[model samples]
Target: MRLLALDRFTWRRIYWILLVFLVILITVWWQPNRTFPTGGSLARDSANPQQVKGAIQPIPLSVDLDVEKVALGEELFRDKRLSADNQVSCLSCHHFKRGGADRQTYSVGSGGVPGDINALTVFNAGFNFRFNWNGAYETLEDQIQATLQNPKAMGSQWNEVVEELQATPEYPKLFARAYADGLTAENIKDAIATYIKSLYTPNSRFDQYLKGDEQALTPDEKAGYQLFQDYGCISCHQGMNIGGNMFQRFGVIGDYFDPKDGITQADLGYYNVTKDEADRYVFRVPSLRNVALTAPYMHNGSVETLEEMVKIVAKAQLGRTLSEGDTDLIVQFLKTLTGEYLGGSLEKLALDSDDDITS
Candidate 1:
């Protein structure tokens, strides 16, 4: 009798398990349309650009640079006094010699704290639509202010920043030459922004080819360019900088966030700022200028190699995987996008010292 009761209890438990599975199956089956991006719920092709229909026009390198403002801006760009610890400067992470990025997975900021996102290259950042991956700041001034205060970044309060700069004997004169009112926060931001504005790059091999110099790019690069457009990378990345004009989800046709990485809050990209459901997982498309130099790509600094980046982009963004040869050709094509600054050097501006500034 005890053995019979034991078997009956086990059968009851089995029945309950089956019932629960059926309920779950019904719930999931009813929500068939709610599958992930690659499952066809979201507009993958809409997010992946196909052509450079309208891109921001590239500025000619021959155009005269504003030397005074650029010089003053260059001083501030390298000034560590702008930060609280007198260590971190704009150049600390965005190294010009390294293609505007420190090439690390994450950059060390003030007090040795690390930034969550990788720094974008300053080479052609001026042409981007919105600043930062989240599109937080609209202008360069706003971005500067945010960077100065963010504890995970420069960590200096705005007032403290101004006070430190004010105490410096060399900044006022530089500010005076750059702006109508010298050394004020507004003018300080303006000068820095002006300097960054002057950091535009042009005269890349791609630009030469675009201007009708067919021989500028090699055969492999030309093939890569064709694949780049044919596979639809040009749609979003078409602009002068080859991107930065719009926002896109990191994975257009897939959920890029791997739960196995212990990820909790779905990287709710621009949606965090906009509070719109559709904006979820969206980030500002970064410029590919000097892409060959920038390593540890993406906002999270997840991907390390450019070749792997290309593969991921091809599969997730383009809804297809590229052949090894195609990827190699595409990489070759991307290499030609590196541009030259007309009259300035990123290395010089980044490594400038406080003693170099004029009062």
Candidate 2:
């Protein structure tokens, strides 16, 4: 009887091990695009790739730029006088070396006040028809003025900023050279706006591939692009900037925010601008150029790695939870979007690997 009992117990243990192995095998087999694109180009393999073609357009390598205006804007963007305490400038939040973003969910501004929302990249500001996450300002100059006046940002009115610049002898001559109107508040906005517009980045590997350079991207990257399109990421994130073209509701398939998690007024999104119920949670889509270089993704900057961000976006926007291997494959494609900085090269920016995104 003892011998019979031992044999039964051993068989039970073997049965359990086989069950576990089968589960893993079935899981892998069930999920399509587990490690790469299922087959061919997205257009050929996908049921409707032509419909997606208009959703995303490639960026050009370069654009006609005004060198003088961009130079002045670059200087003013770094000069701390734009802030009330002379302690903050645009560069404080948007670092050139850091994909034109501070990588902070909430950036500190004038008077050491933390900004309410995440700072968006200024790298491709010119491509967007509207500015700011809420599309609050229609033009970059308007956005500049809002920043200069917002207490949490520059924290000063135009008169004080203009007066300070007028007293500075060097600024007067620089302004005169850039604009016929010279160093007035309007001209300041114009020159700075011109410069900000010139901050466009291009010549990424993906762009080269779009320009008919077949070898610009690797096999994995190409698969990722195919998955990117197949998964409907191209729906909102299209156009020259790969996003920043229109507004979309934050949680299309699922509610992403909870007031219990310390939600603030900024979370209300375009509702704050229009005061309409339908406008709630509507925000301008951010550009994906240099996305690999810019970490801590999302408007809140809450998501950590690119893989995790893709999963969250898939769930919230498309109502799908991707397999781990599929997520990694899509991330491989996004890395190809990192491009050369306009007028210079961009070093791969550091990521905040310590982010706690368990929630």
TM-score of each: 0.79, 0.82
- lDDT tens string, model 2, 1-359? 99999999999999999999999999988864432221123333346766666565566666777888879988898889989999888887887666888777777788988778778888888899799888888998899988999987888889999999999979999999988888999888887888888777787888888888989999988988888887777766778999887777787775777777976778778898999998788788778888876777877788878988899888877777899888988999888887776445565433433243211
lDDT of 1 by residue, 248-313 (tens): 887787777676875533267788789998988887777887787777888777898889999988
Candidate 1 Cα errors over 4 Å, as ranges: 1-59, 62-65, 264-266, 343-359
Among the numbered candidates, top lDDT falls to 2
Cα deviation of 75, candidate 2, in Å = 1.5
Candidate 2, superposed: residue stretches over 4 Å from native: 1-46, 348-359
Best by TM-score: 2
Roughly what TM-score does model 2 have, to 2 decimal places?
0.82
- Which consecutive 10 residues in model 2 have the weakest lDDT in total? 34-43
Q: Score candidate 2 by lDDT.
A: 0.80
Q: Candidate 2 has which clashing residue pairs, if any? A: none
